[model samples]
Target: MALGSLGLVAGALLIAASSRWLPGELPSYPPAQNAAEARPAASLAIHDARPGQPARRIAEDLIAPPPLDVAGVERIEPRPPLGELGLASPPQTPMPQDWRETLLYRPVATSSAIFEAMGRRVVISGTIDVDPDRTCAFGDAVWPCGQRARAAFNAWLRGRALKCVLPPDVDRFGVAAPCMLGKQDVGAWLVGNGWAMASPSGIYGKAEAAARGAEMGIFGPPQ
Candidate 1:
């Protein structure tokens, strides 16, 4: 009985020592939240609600009207007299050095006294009244001057291409400003042969006078 009492006392002392030394219970937490409650709050937007059909009428009032001409499309049309574009007319291109060698001259075709050769419409520059109806006063009678001019020009060319200098710029008919055949001036030739007349410009009066004295081509033989 004394041994049993000692054993009980030892067990009671171990329990008390454990209670003093061991850790206390952990602090508690609330139950887990639901998915909906956990979501973030959204920012708010302002809106004014309309009462009725008057709001629809107000929207129609904001609409735009149809254009003046619904059926026609707008177009840009170019009109004549281009001066409005604020640019002077462009100048013609200059002749290249190689062009002189390639005249590929054929006998010129004459309409009235205007002749075309090497793709240029050349008249005796500054000649007046050389066209078909122009008259030559030969002796006492008058005859068509352009006819004699054509024949004379053909005879002079004799089926050989003449090298000519085109103008630095071309004219409306695309004739060179000045042209030549060898040392001879083609325009002067026409005047000297009486095939053309010096213009009021009077640049070739001497040639015209010489032809008149000789009575060649357009200047007919004595009546």
Candidate 2:
């Protein structure tokens, strides 16, 4: 009839262009509201509300208790109470030069003597009672006989050789007072045997007076 009315108007415009391109069934989402603030305000204020029992004795009886009159607090004077201010009694530490000890023999009127070897060396010799005519020529120049001949020539130069003894005294010229053959240095062997002359304050007085004036033993002949 008009091509059946234009084929029913072209099938109703292809069903309205396929219901406007096919996708419409999503509309049911409403379940997520926790905006967070139902009355919450406690950043840190419990001050030991006494729950279990010992939070440091309830935080030191509720918050601050330590300075009860520490009175001026500077103190440092207690060391004096141990020996009470006299502090010098503790300083006697001097005995180690190899620690040999034992020197008290008393009897060298001079003309020295000593010989004790085997270590601790001692060989001093005799006839040094010094008397170039006396005005103090060396009994160690007098007084307790030069302190007992320098304590018996320092106790035979400190022991060994049957404990080197000898201290009976007799020097104004007698001679029995200078003995010690065991510990050597008999006045540097009586000044190397010229009978003795070295004492310019000794240290082997000029090499025992040039080896006793070059062997004239007793200061003779070497001009």
Candidate 3:
């Protein structure tokens, strides 16, 4: 029995010695041991070890701005109500009414006539005024369109009454206003006849376009 035990012990010792020489897994270490192995002793000494400061992880060491507190921040003041500013609303002007008046014999221009009652020159609205000395092109030839336009206007007027939308009090200087010859709008007639252009107000744009398309009066051969 003693000899058998001695042989078993010898066999165990042999097995241990052979296992140590064989391939095996490498030993593992804790995180503190790993950091100590990676860094130099001088680099580790530079870190602060002051009291009251807790050791920080990589995530905690990152820079981060403080969160904003909207409720605690100062706010801008709002503007006061318009009524409390002591301002008054602007006054509106009433529209002028139509008035009937007789003309002083003839029209001064294709788009203007003299009112006999007020002796004030009223330019027909919606028509651009053409100087009496102005000329126009007709197939490479120029003609006195302005004079012809005025003559045509004079013939149409023939000392007749005009219905105008003018103020009751006459203007010291001339003013442009809508006028009617019987039931016809004088401005529309002038623009439609191609004797005058439509004003920038676009009131007679269609009429001017029609006359231009048809090549009538000044837009065509002189009448």
Per-residue alpha-carbon lDDT of candidate 1 for residues 1-223, written as tens digits (9 for 90 to 100): 9999999999999999778754545433675567755665442222345776333223433356745785686787777775434645334346565444324277564742356765667655556546665666666777776766676777777667666555543435655334456777766777877777776563566678888898776776522
Where model 2 places Cα greater than 4 Å from the true spot, the runs are 1-43, 49-71, 78-149, 158-223
- Residues 1-223, model 2: lDDT tens digits: 9999999999999989777765654443664444443335443334554678754323444366665777776877665456434433333234335433233343322223433232222323223443323222322233232333344444544443323222332122221222334565455545554444554434455556576457543333311
Worst 10 residues of 3 by lDDT: 108-117
lDDT of 3 at 21: 62
lDDT, candidate 3, at 131? 73
Which 10-residue span in candidate 1 carries the lowest summed lDDT? 53-62
Per-candidate RMSD, Å: 17.3, 20.8, 17.7
TM-score of 1: 0.45
Candidate 2 least-lDDT 10 residues = 169-178
TM-score of each candidate? 0.45, 0.19, 0.51
lDDT of 2 at 38: 38
Segments in model 1 whose C-alpha atoms lie over 4 Å from true places: 1-104, 111-113, 167-172
Residue 3 displacement (Å), model 2? 29
Return the TM-score for candidate 2, rounded to 2 decimals.
0.19
